[model samples]
Target: MPELPDVEGFRQVLLTCRGRRSVTDVDVRDAGVLRGVSEERLRKELEGRRLGKAWRHGKWLFVPTGDGPTLVFHFGMTGSLRCCDQEEPIEAHDRIVLTLGGERLLCYRDQRKLQGVRLADSADVDRILEGLGPDALAVDRDEFLELLSGRRGAVKSALMDQSVVAGLGNLLCDEILWRARVAPRTSTRSLSEKTLRRIHAAMGRVLATSVRDGCVPPRRSWLTGRRDDSEPVCPRCGTSMRSTRIAGRRTVWCPHCQN
Candidate 1:
């Protein structure tokens, strides 16, 4: 799945699509990747309109148009955006193509049509985004502590809950828990203030490193780096890592370290 860092990289791709670029054409190869708007509406709304700055919140990417509407993208499990020359051969997965300024083409590609593109006016965009919690990267330590305070779910579940803090996926939750030395099944209410602070710190560090690497990098030194090994060992303690399902997601933790 494309998480925060991957979506951030998509946002960078959008930077090349914006600023004085007029949409010359829109080819909808697969309408399954579009939500709430039909192919005709998409073409009518986009063609000839100039693209402005691009914005990203959590896993969602938004591109403002010269007209009022913004092109929004939610990269479900396997979705991405790319900018290519008009003559470049299109991939089979490239569902939507927006020819920009008669030179560059912006493509919306997805393997699983789980989440798709949406066109929303500013007010509609704000209303739609109101349901999402604060972006994980934007939330500070104090805010993170407050969000986790008094939560009843397991720490890993709480971290993966989009309503609690947007942008975290399975890998991020597990990595954060491992770094903080907290069991995935540990309850947030059971966590002490010191533990919460540790979690907050680990969250910051993990997000920074992942965002920099443009993925939850499975470096050899990190837990993710070793979790899939034949006999996964704790990267820090040299102990065998433990695995279980928390909130229906596979979670790996170090029993000795997290205990």
Candidate 2:
């Protein structure tokens, strides 16, 4: 699934769509990629509108049209936004393509259309944002601690819950916990203030690095680097890494460090 870092990368892709370029065409190769708007309505609303500022919240990317509506994208599991040449051959997975100034092509490509694109006006955007928790990267330390204070569930689950803190996925949850030396099964309510501080700091560091790299980079020194090993070992202590289901997702943790 596309996480915060990945969506941030997509926001960068949307940057090219901004400025003076007008959308000359809106081609819907798969309407399944369209959430609420019909193909005709999408084309009608966007065919000649200029793209303005772009914003991202959690895993959602929003590109505002000068006309008022914003094009919101959620890159489900395998979805991606690719800026390519209009003359180039379209990939089989290209669900929607917007021709910009008849020069560039902003394509929404997805093999599994689990989550795709939606069109929203300013009021609708506010409503959608009202339901989401703060973006993990933008939340301040004090706010982060406050958010975690009420959760009694496993910390890992709380981390992955979009309503609790948006943008963290399975890999990010595991990586942050590993870096904080906190077990995935640790209850949120049991965490000391110091531990929560460590977790928040680790999350910020990890997100900064991952957002810069545009993915949860699997560097060898990080737990994510070895989580897929046949028999994974801790990067810090060389102890065998432990794995089990937590929050119904496979979790990897350093037993020695996190205990």
Candidate 3:
């Protein structure tokens, strides 16, 4: 699934394609990827509006068009945003296309159609985002500590819960736990302040690098890089890594390093 870093990259794509340009047309190739709004309404609302500065919260991307409705995107497992030349071939998965000033195409491509587009007013946007916690990229260490301190459940589960801290997916939670040398199954309430601080620091470092790279990079030295090996080994301790399901997601951790 596309995580926070991936969604951030999509925001950049939107910004690049929408710079000072008005939407010349709206084409909904697959209405299955749209939610709450009809194709006619989407076209009617956004066809000629100028796109404002796009922003992201957690995994959601919001594109405001001046005083009009906001265009919201949630890139599910196989969704992405792309900017292509007007003459370029549209991929089979390009569900929605926005012609910008008739000069370029902004495409919303999704293979799975699990999540897709929505049109929201200010109040609707608020209600849509009301269930989410503080964005992972913006939460401070003290706030992170407090959020986890009040939670009960495995530490990994807490991290993956959007209501507890948004933007962390299975991969990010595993990477953060591995870097912090904390076991995935450790109880949130059992974590000492020092351990929680370490986890927060690891999250910061991991998110910083991931955001810059636009994904959780699979660098050889990182656990993410080695998780898929035929016989995966801990990059730090060289012990064979362990894999199990935690919070209903496959988790990879180093028994020797994280014990």
Candidate 4:
């Protein structure tokens, strides 16, 4: 799953490759990766428009064009964007291609063909994003603390809920919990003010680190580094790591360190 860090890296890809380039051709190899807009409409709307600045909110990437259209992309489970020359051999899964400025080609690739792309006018984009809570990277301490007040769900579930804080996925959820010394299953209401404050601080630190690294780097020091081991040991402590499902998503936590 491409999370906040990965999508932030993709935003950089757009910055380096597509910004200021005029779309000369639009090719939809697999229309399944498109939502709400048809292939014909996509081609008509995108071609000839110059890609302006790009932005990201959580896992969604927004590329605005000069013509007032925003190209919205949700990289469901296995989707990514790349920039290459048109002469480069296209991968089999590259679903959409935007030829830019007669030199560069931007490709939207996905293996599972899950959540794909959409085009929205400014107003439509606002409506689409209306229900999402404050972005994890953008929320202030007071807002974060207020959001967690009175919640009964496990802290991990609360953190991963997009409505609670956008952009936190399973890995981020576990990492933040582990850093805050909060067990993954600890109920939100059980958390004291001091502990909740720690969690908020940890969230900001971890998110800043991940974004700086361009992804949640799986370094030996990070919990992500050991999450997939068949018999994983905690990187912070010597105890064996545990794996379970929380909120229907696979979760990894260090039993000794998190609690």
Candidate 5:
């Protein structure tokens, strides 16, 4: 699944391809990738509008067109945004293509088509984002602690919950808990303030590097680097790692280190 870092990278693609440039054409190669808006409406709303600054919150990317509607993207599992040459052949998964000033093509490509695109006005944007909690990258330590304090499930579940702290997915939650030395099954309500603070700090450091790299880089020193090993071991302590399901997703941790 495309997470916050991947979505942030897509925002950069939007800015680099279309910032300040007017959309000369809109092609809906697959209308099934659109939400609520018709193909004709999408083309009508965006054709001659200048794209403003693009922003990202959690895994969602938003592109505003000055006074026109904002284009919202939620890259579910196999979705991505690509900037390619207009002369290049469209891939099999290119669902929508937007021509920027007749120079380049911005493609919305997805294999699964789980979540696609939406066109929203200012009010619609607000309503769409109202259900999400504060973005994981923007929440302060105190606010992070407060947000987890009210949760009643495992700490991993709380971190992965979009309603509790938007943006964290399965890989991120496991990595954060490992760095904080917190077990995956640890209850959020039983956590101490100091522990919560540690988790918050780990999240900051992880997100900073991940956002810069545009993915959860599988570094040898990081848990992600070893999680897929035939028999994964902790990079720090060399203890054999364990895996189980939590929040209906595969969860991995080092029993010795996290204990």
Candidate 6:
């Protein structure tokens, strides 16, 4: 699954590969990856327009064109943007391709096609983003505390709620809880002020590290780094790690480190 860190990495790819480049052609090999736009319209609206700027909000990536519309992308499970030469063979799963100057091609490839692309104007972007809460990476300590204080569900569940804080997925929610020494199933309303503060701090720290590394790297000292072992053990205390579903996603935590 592409989380905040993964989307941030994609934003970098877009900036480097397609920014300011003129779209010479828009080819939609699989229209299933498009929403509210047809193949002909996609080509008509996007082709020949210059990619003006690219920005990411939560899990969404927006690539705007000077011609008045922005290309929106959401990678549901296995979507990514790739840059390759025109001479290179088209990938089997490539759904959308934008041919650019210098023989460069920007491809939107997704195996599952769970989420796809859209064309939006500035007005449309505002409407789509109106319901989302402050980004997990951008929320302040006070805002995070206030948001967490009102939730009655498990801390892990609250963390994964997009309305509470956007951009945190299952892995990030569990990892942050483990780092903050809070159990995954702990009730959000039962948390103390100090614990909430620690959780907020940990969220920022983890996001920064993951974005810097271009992924949520599981280090030997980190629970994520060790959670996939045949017999995973807590890095801090040798106790076996636990795994279960919380908020409908596989959750991992160290019993010794958390709770």
Candidate No. with top TM-score: 3
In model 5, the Cα lDDT at residue 176 comes to: 91
Tens digits of lDDT, candidate 3, 177-255: 9999999999999999999999999999999999999999999999999988999999998999999999899999999
Residue 160 error, candidate 6, Å: 0.8
**Which regions of candidate 1 fall more than 4 Å away from where they truly are?**
17-20
Tens digit of lDDT per residue, candidate 5, span 1-259? Answer: 6888889999888878745789999999999999999999999999999888998888888999888999999999889999988899999899999999898899999999999999999898898688788999999999998888877789999998888888998888889999999998998988999999999999999999999998888998999999999999999999999999999999999999885
lDDT of 6 by residue, 170-192 (tens): 77887788888899999999999
Pairs with backbone N, CA or C atoms under 3 Å apart (clashes), candidate 5: none
Q: Each model's TM-score, in the order given?
A: 0.94, 0.96, 0.97, 0.96, 0.96, 0.96
Q: Write the residue-wise lDDT of candidate 4 on 163-188 in tens digits.
A: 77889888888888988988899999
Mind giving the per-residue lDDT tens digits that candidate 1 earns over 161-240?
Answer: 88888899888888888899989899899999899889888988999999898888999889989878988999999999
Q: Give the total clashing residue pairs for model 2.
A: 0
Q: Rate the local accuracy (lDDT) of all candidates.
A: 0.88, 0.91, 0.92, 0.88, 0.91, 0.87
Write down the lDDT that model 4 would get.
Answer: 0.88
Which residue pairs clash in candidate 6?
A: 218-225
